[model samples]
Target: MKITRVYAAVLALTSLLFINCSKGDDDNGGNPPVQETPTIEGTWKVVTNNYFEDSKYFVINEDNTLHIFYEDNLGFKDTQNANYTNNEEELQLTINFGYGSLLANYTVSSDDLVLNFPDGSISLTKETTALAPDNWIKTLKIINEGNAPWTERIDIAWNGSQLVIGNGYEAEAIGLVNPETFALEGTITTSRHAFAVEIENYDDEEKYIFQSDNGSNKFHMYDLADNTHEDESLPLGSWIYGLASIDYQTIWASSNNEDSIYLYDYDSKTIVQTIDLGERSPNGLDYQAGYLYICANGQLYKCDVSDGLEVIESYTLPDYSITGVAYDGSYFWVYAEKNNEGKLVQLDLSI
Candidate 1:
């Protein structure tokens, strides 16, 4: 899934790839202690993130399993359960979070433990208190549901008071709802499925609404200032399943049947970067600061934008079908739809 590097930084980063930790003195009935893999089982807390601190934690148990836990501000709990294999060097984590096993460069140095991703890295500290065994991942709570039976993608945007949602499959409408009360505002139809919607006010006339489609693979840029549209389709060359605006000029989109995401520069009217994700069907992407959280295959991935779309952390929603994700500084707004039933949940990342 590697593509030709267009930037020098990406070319230089080809050196930091994770190597198999199984490199040690051959072990037999007479294995030396110096070549044996050290124990990495214990508790680790997230130490660095652009948005929040101490919000994420993981417990790597010696029982060949690991638990990643998240507690939101509202007391809702979310977690990931995965099987792990530590080959005396690297921990091959088989996160049932969709994409199966992920090889992370593991290094434990005193107070800090680092797991390097393909392009980015995550630093976890030794937790002062080990979490209780019974205190593993908890069941999620449903906060709100869309008024209309949402049949398509459930990508949402926050515009201060209300959440503007993209409408149904091949939708001819866009919906607005209060995030707090789930009160529905009047929906306006436009004869296109707003499969993915992004809210941006980047020094424009006012806030603008950007839509990425599932059917036409086009972009419908609507100016909220004048209630007019600059509807145009770009050569996506694939089906776009989601959209997220990075700024006024740049927006990111996810493609289905392809493992890569496309960086569309609306100002330039061209595809800037076609990010290659080795995993298939990159869907429902949202950008905040330097990270992009994407929902695909029931897994939520936190990706670093500086490098080649490297996944820093991936959390899987086992048994649950989560479709989209959005990060708004404090919390990660997660969405799920089943049988035309739409539900939105808020995860307080500050917690």
Candidate 2:
């Protein structure tokens, strides 16, 4: 009678185990599969181009219209109108002015996107935060170095507390001074013939320095790490009067003669891209926030460098012979030579 009771208990335990296994399989069937997120709609801007150090800052409207603002390396702004359309996988943008439309394949990766053009390509990264207010105020104070006669074209770059000013046309040293008091911090005379056209802090360890002859078509690169300049020089095809470094590896140089902007790769020592601005000679160039601001033929233009190099918006300046341009977070600063005195005008860009 005890052996019979033991067999009956064993059968009961096996029946319970089979029921639990069946319930586990049914639970697995109830789970759902994951789905891909939809592509972002509405207009977008090309805030940065990693391929070409140039930026095309533009806007896309829901109505399929596109606006472009572009500046050559020479500080000339070229404004053009166009239309654009995208189907998530492919994008077709047509610039109505001169050059034909640009067709490319586009891909989205997480929050970042890449557009592959026929000749080259551009990548776009979303902005984490909105830009600060445009409220830049400039106080210009002339400094006299006696008989030395301060460099004609001085490029200014702010480094947190102080501003570094560089002299053009083979100036030996870069001047560091207080932005408010204009007090001299000291001079950096590492390069023997430092044209000091543009100075930019690329990373924690290095700063990029560009210099070119006023008449010649060659530009020099100086690495601030070892305070040494490169042996090889970059050819601009035409005389490079103005330049700006987008990053440590790329530079945008403007040719006054050709009326064009050329993008150069500092790492590989090659010309990667070029934008023809026609007869308008580019004078000064600056990359503010994510837009490439150019002063060309008395106009200001901005481009979306990440969105297939599209021009987005532009405004004509009162003075056509603008010399240089700078953006101090908010306002667009224009330097022009009118009459005998040089004039620095501030333009409001709050809109």
Candidate 3:
């Protein structure tokens, strides 16, 4: 009887082990989810290749033409043109140019881009892809904020389906307007005089930002998930004129009365790096197509973020006081105000 019991116990233990292994192997039942590869038709700055210190950039377009600009260490600049073909299915690229044809393989995961060549591999970082600078054409006029006329130093941002508007002249509230018709939806009141209003969208919720003048905590964060304003003690400084972010934590802000962009650390709540905007006052910024487009000096300046926020392109707007700017995937909406009256303008952008 004892031997029989021992045999049954060993068999049960083996069965349990087999069941556990089977459950582990089929956790997802089949293949895991796959993320889509982002579009790669844009400008890329060479981060690493054969040349270590030389500045190199390539404008890869959908028209089979690649515009190359290179600056050597001796301050010599060269402009080269080449024709290229790509096979997205096979991830292969062939360049036909002056001397001969060179074949390469490329892959883009998230924002990092890699081009593998026959001679050597080139790792490029995206500045702005599939964005044309010259294609920004004005698309009629937009209406005004419904509740009241916009005060001075008006700022604009997009939060989900609405445009959040703020101003520096009033210590009232942040106005939410329809992005299409500019009709007022609602308002989120604040006790501080707000200058910049921006939102950081996460997976499930959004964190709204209401920034003020150079007084105290310059900005206050409001989370949509809990519907509360974190104003007990903000760990940041003042004079934060503009705010934007491609990612949630790496918040980039422009200072008031200064042509400066500061990378704000969320945890530390301090300026991580201060980059010179090369202008007197860089205000009202939005991060679009890997560039920080700032409404400053009566124009929209595209800063090459991959090159230390250097102004690469500027689009002249009307002579009115332009307060804020926002990008809505296909078009750029700018806030132009004069004497408390505001007008939203849509711009069609191209390269």
Candidate 4:
């Protein structure tokens, strides 16, 4: 009786051990671990080609919605609202347009993104959405606050000493402003309407101011020695909005009507090169070192000096209309208008 009882106990213990082992095996093999999906929620700057398609970017939100900006066939800036579904391996975009759905294989790293489509892949860098530093300090109030027309202050240039301003409403003279006091110390009397002013200071002996005539599609050159126009005028087919001088032989002029910058040969009095700014209306232009700083659409753009003139950097300014930009060795003097008030703002290179 005792041996039978012991044998029963051993069998019960063996059954319990076997049941637990089976449960462990089932837990190990019954299901696999799930993987977390990769996230694609950020603003991305498109850098597929060497030149930046400024109109092209992606703004993906957390709610599966996105905004894609691009230039249409009509050369107009356009945006598309879309819903996006992203996984670890694929991304699907459902645009509001007639196109139903488009899929692409994508990869995301720390700061880089690559979307592989049927044709090719588009490369993008994650854009930092941090607001620009508040480094712009207003130094002068050039225009009063009210319903003043934008033509009150048009352009500005740093002449190594004072600020030469173009008063678009005034047809007879350009004002020479004292940068220190923000006062209209003197005026350069000329017959041409001053819409844009640039100083071509080859040397102390040969300093001249180039002004774009607002009354007509033309430009005039005035000698600073006597503040005289010398009757030197050139026919500009389009409305020239800004001018910048490189040397005694080269000058750059921006045309708002044509959305292009013309490289004029001062000696030949002819346009040697034309840089097309693809749909961007350039307002003002200034040159420093080898880069061209452009004021377009209330922002400042820095472009290279090469043939392509690829935009290297872009800075967002205050919520004001940027009319002109000038670099004065240390600070950047910007002519901005807001609430019908125009001012000369001084900003450091931090922007």
1-351: candidate 1 lDDT, tens digit per residue: 335545655756653332222333244325645554345678988876433222488788888788777654322234666787766533534334455667666677556777765665667888768984345432344434444335455677766566667774734677767666776765655556677777773656576677766655677787775657875648673566678888887888877757668888888888888876654566677887767777776556676777566655556433456677665556667667555567666664421
Per-residue accuracy of model 2 over 225-267 as CA lDDT, tens digit each:
5657764457675566667778877777777788887878878
CA-lDDT, candidates in order:
0.65, 0.56, 0.65, 0.68
What is the lDDT for 230 in model 2?
Answer: 64
Name the lDDT of candidate 2: 0.56
TM-score of each: 0.58, 0.49, 0.54, 0.65
**Top candidate when judged by TM-score against the true structure:** 4
- 2 against 3, candidate with superior lDDT: 3
Clash count, candidate 4: 0
Model 1 misplacement above 4 A = 1-151, 201-205, 231-233, 317-319, 338-340
- Supply the global lDDT for candidate 4: 0.68
Q: After superposition, how far is residue 244 of candidate 4 from its true place, in Å?
A: 0.2
Which of candidates 1 and 4 reaches a greater lDDT? 4
